[model samples]
Target: MNPEDWIAHDPDPVTAAELAALDPGERAARFARPLTFGTAGLRGPVRGGPDSMNLAVVVRATWAVSRVLTERGLGGSTVVVGRDARHGSAQFAVAAAEVFAAQGFSVISWEHPVPTPVVAFAVRRTGAAAGVQITASHNPRTDNGYKVYFDGGLQIVSPTDREIEAAITTAPPADEIRRRPVHPDDDTLVDAYVARAATVRRGRHGHPRVALTAMHGVGGELALRALQAAGFDDVHTVASQFAPDPDFPTVAFPNPEEPGAADALLRLADEIGADIAIALDPDADRCAVGIPAAGGWRMLSGDETGWLLGDYILSTLDGADAATSVVASSVVSSQLLATIAADYGARHVVTLTGFKWLARADAELTGCSLVYAYEEAIGHCVDPAAVRDKDGISAAVLACDLVAHVAAQGISITDALDRLALRHGVHTTAALSRRVADPGEAAAMMDRLRSNPPAELAGFPVTATADGDAVFLTGGDQQTTVRVVVRPSGTEPKVKCYTEVGQAVGADLDDARRRAAAIELQLLASAQTW
Candidate 1:
């Protein structure tokens, strides 16, 4: 990745010129190597370097995808390319389509901004060879990404990701790749997605007041369509964030899980006295929910929402055969979902993090059905058959449906959660993330934790501690007290700690939550000191 070599091969003049202008130190640092592509695909600052995500990088990545497709006997097959409303997303998406077409593959381009899950849906519905979404999810405005999905509508996995990276190593210059832009009528795919999303609705209440925000991304319009189609007519979107704006004007960050990100949506819900509130990330693959609390509204954590939705879905299958139900959650997520599934005579499966692992849980657990899979990061796969990925739109519909159903019975979501606490244990989860200037700092922090494994946390004896890429620590019995998982973020330059604590339903929920927060802060505080 020498500067001159990259300059010679790069097709985009802007990036080439940028590389040419950089000093030796800058050039070496920027072009020392290509950005690594893991389960999350390629992501970095949207600039003009081999380490950046620009037109040249897109072309090379698309070329790699094309080669892998061809090697797998999918030479002339179609690839679905979608994008969000980021700065270079549309251009990158079209460039990807051209590269696919040039490689003798058919191109299915969105031709406009769409959510990441739309790419997954289009791939599954069209039987395309693969799908590429030009987005960065909830990353900063200066950043962008390329997320790849495969034939079965799952993100590209281990051996395949490595293969694509290998092809990228020797990709031809961008100009040498063929280019024929093919645009399908966008209305067809959109209509199909809307229809499929509406099918997840199972409610007895009509038009319960709802409030929503897209966090200045592409999910607003599509989510509106799906919600209205699913009989939620009284939906009110936060006006300021309804349109797509790459700068994310209203909040410090666009992710709903962040502190101030969902403030505008909750404010609107309060102003309108809406029954429920919804927040979708920049690209809308994940969802976060809010419900009416004691005095105002409180946004539910990802695990709380995931458990509520999983329980709701399972309750609908009250009189089914043994093949009726299967639900899943990530290993780091709360185990209450498993308890609920078992109570309902359903099977529960736990997989590694990411929807790519959770999406195809049905294959891993045969016989039972695949009803739901969720993670603690606001990701839920409610309708796994339709979109084999975490789908914010469908999850929102299910959330609203749950609200309306409960409202029909004179109970709010708060009451339902209380009942769940009484039925199952009061399981609460918290997360702590420490940002560092360099990723190496994350490794160092994890090393420190592994070296001095805590025998106890928050006055509770540690029952177990395991280490690999991360350090997993448990305090007291797993059913009570705490579970701590300290790991580097799959993406981004940060180390994250996830903690879930529980107190038996007859005990105090506040006590469990306070102790969990204390332990989480203690771990993160220790990391800061290190």
Candidate 2:
């Protein structure tokens, strides 16, 4: 180990030593590429280089953030940090806190593991300049992440992410990044958030009973606490996977949207004869609901759940001046929300595909009260007053409340959705993904799609084509979108392509399902080239 290697190679002492210790192949794998930070923040496989999120990289990131905050007049501002049950999460959280405290900034670290949303809420609720959460979200166990949220209580946006990346690039070295020991804040931010969520919207009648699953994450306690506070006592918490375990022992993947993901919770719902099973992702930022339908438990897609929530909220407006305005992402199923908004004389706005944008907009906007906002990825923001970001706890309670209302009418969420579709026409959403090994390959795929744009897809004219990552299409009164959103996932080897298609509703359920299936095939055909 030559000292000159530190000067010629990596400047960071910790990273340099770690790299030197590794063999040739190992070092090449670790230093394959630099960490790419974007709207999602810096995330990578837990490995050996500055590119990956090792201990040294984590320290560098925190120190860089400390420098940025200080330069931005938020130098002495306090920060609240939290983590989920992902591997190395607690250690990362502690490292961040120590770095911030060493920089003379007050730190309030979580006493125990908590959800990502809770950390976002604490950041804003406590008037901190920024917050960090250590979790890989729904990614595979081999992955982990560092997600940053701003004062506005949303994930750090574009330019901000770039600036933070620059800060990290300019840091002296990993070991030089000052870090001081700090203890967790005695304060209870999640408790206060739970208390506030309880008051989202009191039903004049009664709250619905619900079966809840944390997907082996950290939302069970908060969900239970909020449900009880909201006057719903019949909430049944799933016994298995209820406790927070970073390993996620039960499920292959911790996402609620994945196939067979909610099987355990569905079984529990059947056992309890519960009307619905509510499942949240590991970070508690995304949610899914399953209702007892035909012979088995049927789970609703993210768009379906958002539409149900939107319809319920909009229906309650009662054509008053205080009509609810629904907000959804540009890529989400806008047909349902648009129809409801038009019929009820409410407003609807479309933003980029991220809850951070939705939550920040909800917090900043004043004229219209945001009743509902959701993305097709299962991220939802119900009440900005209680939480500027997504809240699975609030979504759980809202799910119960909506289920109770529909059950009173002797129908399930599926039936209600059918009715809505029959009245305003049905719409279906779908996605197509192309995975590649390297970021360069992902970029090349996008370039290929851009160079050879499809004029028509599934016999429908391409409405618009985005050369960058996504493509959009529409046909007749009914519209279908085939987006080729290409990006190297923050925590995985594969790049993702999100595609969607929609069709008008008919009198029969089978017909609607058939039409949706055909449209899905067409969308898939078009995505083949992309």
Candidate 3:
């Protein structure tokens, strides 16, 4: 469709004006291709064209989602809609709710901005057929997104995502889609989510001081509430970052994983003499942890946090049926969790990267439950039964519980990690990425790597190679094991390489850690060349 035709169909005058103001070349680019709905749902800049996120795009996408659900025999069922504090989120969320209501489905909408996990929890709690959240997560301020979760509160994957895209391709123009103005639902769901999140905490061990930052996102208040509800009263917050600000004025990027994103939180932790610090992404779906180091306050790598949480959660499940309980991690994550699960006699499954896949780790096993799942990108599902997706709020609560439990035992978080390293070798991990012009270039890079597998990476012979959603290379000597996984990032135009070097604990733990870190840097450097 041309720009003029798209402007005609645009429901929001703001976006229509935006389209009208675009130059001819820019207008042509906007209409050259429509946004593709993939596993992550629709995400792009907020603009007035089929290629961007706007009222028209949201309506059409919701209509397509409705059609797909109806075809799956979920017609007229309940659908939950929520949004974050990003630009255009409220309007886009309203448009989604209106479309769902017009399609004869019962729509439950939130009047206020909410974290992404609230919608996921609502879907399961209300037994809704689907849920839609308008959020870009940790993306830049200029971007927005539409995330969809099916009946089980898990994000749509594979065939469902493809089906939704196909339906969207045939959707009528935005103006032609029927819509009914709908009011937001009550706060009962949010309240219930908080209650369930609080329940994740075990018995109170100690009240360790904690410093938290929401990263100018929507998770701050709720995280505080959950923590307090779980008997964590000695909590301090980064005052400047507690409130939601769509512009993310403080951090260059909203992601806590990015460099210096948690500086404010760490600063607050130091000022308050906090025992631990936590940072949640914009949508509060990802959680990062910081602890006092020998030099200064340093954030724990995602893998380190994963190891701690996994050990803590598994430790509490003393007499449970380990045969039916499963803990999972992505292929790109460290394999120490598997060893930890083995120690507890629990099963561990490795799935492809993405919470969409990790959420359904126990789907193929009958009479089994996914007790926990995490990825190396600070996304952890500590309470899978409550919320199938990565939830920063609940993870924060659980992390606090872990801290309190360790404090009661006269051990610091660092000491707990050292204990784990002693039990299960020192596992060092790093990630390397190469940005490309577009997704095609990323695919081409992966193809080249797959076609001509490198014989050696950082002087370690590539003893084995496997191809799946990503290429996995395994090599090392008898004393150490080096593994790398390379794949195109689903949400960005970059080829990501995850590297790990594992060595058994010997007489000297510090030496093993230093050697492993050095090898990890080499592996990262070699992977960068590809």
Clashing pairs in 2: 85-246, 426-505, 430-499, 431-499
RMSD of 2: 3.2
Using Cα atoms with residue i matched to residue i, what is each candidate's TM-score against the true structure?
0.96, 0.90, 0.97
Model 2 has an lDDT value of: 0.73
Shift of residue 109 alpha carbon in model 3, Å = 1.0
**Ranking of all predicted structures according to lDDT, beginning with the best and ending with the worst:** 3, 1, 2
- The numbered model that scores best in TM-score is 3
lDDT of 1 by residue, 240-316 (tens): 99999999989887889989888889999999999999999999999999998997899999999988998898888
Candidate 1 lDDT (Cα, 0 to 1)? 0.85
Residues 57-128, model 2: lDDT tens digits: 788788888888888889888887788877778778888899989999998887688877788778778888
Error of 2 at 362 (Å): 5.1
Better of 1 and 2 by lDDT: 1
What C-alpha lDDT values do all the predictions have?
A: 0.85, 0.73, 0.90
Worst 10 residues of 1 by lDDT: 521-530
